[model samples]
Target: MPLPRTAGSALLALALASVAVPASASSTAAAAADVRYVALGDSYASGTGAGSYSDIACTRSRNAYPALWADANDPAAFSFAACGGAKIPDVLADQVDELDEDTTLVSLSIGGNDSGFASTMLSCQYSTQSACERALRTAGEYVVNELPGELDSLYATVRARAPHAEVVIVGYPHLYKEGGLCLGGLSSAKRTAVNQGSDLLNETIAGRAAAAGFAFADGRPAFAGHEICTSDAWISGSNVHPTAEGHESAYLPAFSAAVSGN
Candidate 1:
């Protein structure tokens, strides 16, 4: 796998220094390369509420994992087929021409929805209570049971669509950390439980991806300490999207790792 870019520590500096050179110079950096990249997932992959995309029509945006990977790699070489709030079936649904025969890389961050993670979180209302913790735990189990079949379908779909592509499935970032609750009076132990639940889903992602002949980027560790409720917030608005900086700091690592071919 390509490992996350340590060079990102220096990317902002390069972009800022290059800004004075004019549009043409920036255009050179933005130009597409000859690699095919495909992205499929929910809001984290959607770039929703991040205010970046080709346009509003697709509801898909530019800061999602695929676009971030593209910016790091050759732009022309990549394509973003990910849609916001997408489920495993949704990925199966989108007709990704870009994901077809020529794709060089593919990454997906999904399964949280199947776990009813969003619904659970919403019910907790960001509280810290016993009820909330149990909900998260239940949601996790749901995801564990559901993801394999869903992921198997996804893998088959990719194989049918992008036969030669190196498909990479990106796992979930930790959603809760340090006992911050979905509501009032929740235990920190539940925080650990919810995170563990999310981890279970990740393991499922890894297993299924492996079975289907695809690689999975290790995002949980990379995204550690940067959960949706993290002090620094790596996950974007709620349970869906990732912030622009969040993608840079969190999701981008997985993509970079895959591209590294390490």
Candidate 2:
């Protein structure tokens, strides 16, 4: 009862076609299809100065780094919960809800707002030198003494909510080039102090992120030549927030690299 030669060959081909796809190819496809992203934190994350506000109340900008990332990668889902003026408590209360066990990626830039960064900057720009110094001192103290605990709590909660997510803690940039010159802005001494504060903040945040097993995207190096007082500044003068160029050129690359394990 032997089959004819051509008929037997056709049966062999049919059996080969029924085999499952290779494991490597299947895993790659699953990874590509499972990117559920959630962005959380404050104005820096919300792209307040980058404009194109999607939510005016929260100042959520379409030019934000998270939005840019989502547009480029086209994640399975994206939740932009970062808001202007949000502090750690605010994020814990309002933003963490966006994450769940299904979330695969999360990124945020916070701690600056909680450190009274706005008030300190205003004092440096408009108030007396002594007053500015005092404000910087106060903010620095908070960053050292209080911000760590708050960050730890927030990071822990984020982990609990999105147990499988790859979390990235993005850091703030130095507002001014240390020795760069500008005719009518903060004094050299004030600029130096502000940059020091930024360094301290970034260090603290990076350390906490490491302890929590999260990636830290240090924005300082990326923004080095593009700070507020540069001839081609990436930060807006009005609120010290990153311009659209900054988000696209600086934050985007730094964040993208961190996510890619580079």
RMSD of each: 11.2, 4.4
* Model 1: ten consecutive residues of lowest lDDT: 178-187
lDDT of 1 by residue, 180-218 (tens): 564332356755666676778788888998898777888
Cα-based TM-score, every candidate: 0.75, 0.89
Candidate 1 segments exceeding 4 Å error: 1-34, 55-59, 126-130, 179-187, 228-230, 236-240, 260-262
User: What C-alpha lDDT does candidate 1 achieve relative to the native structure?
Assistant: 0.69
Give residue 240's lDDT in candidate 1 (0 to 100).
43
Which residue ranges in model 2 land beyond 4 Å of their true spot? Answer: 1-29
Candidate number with greatest lDDT: 2
Report the lDDT of model 2 for residue 18: 58
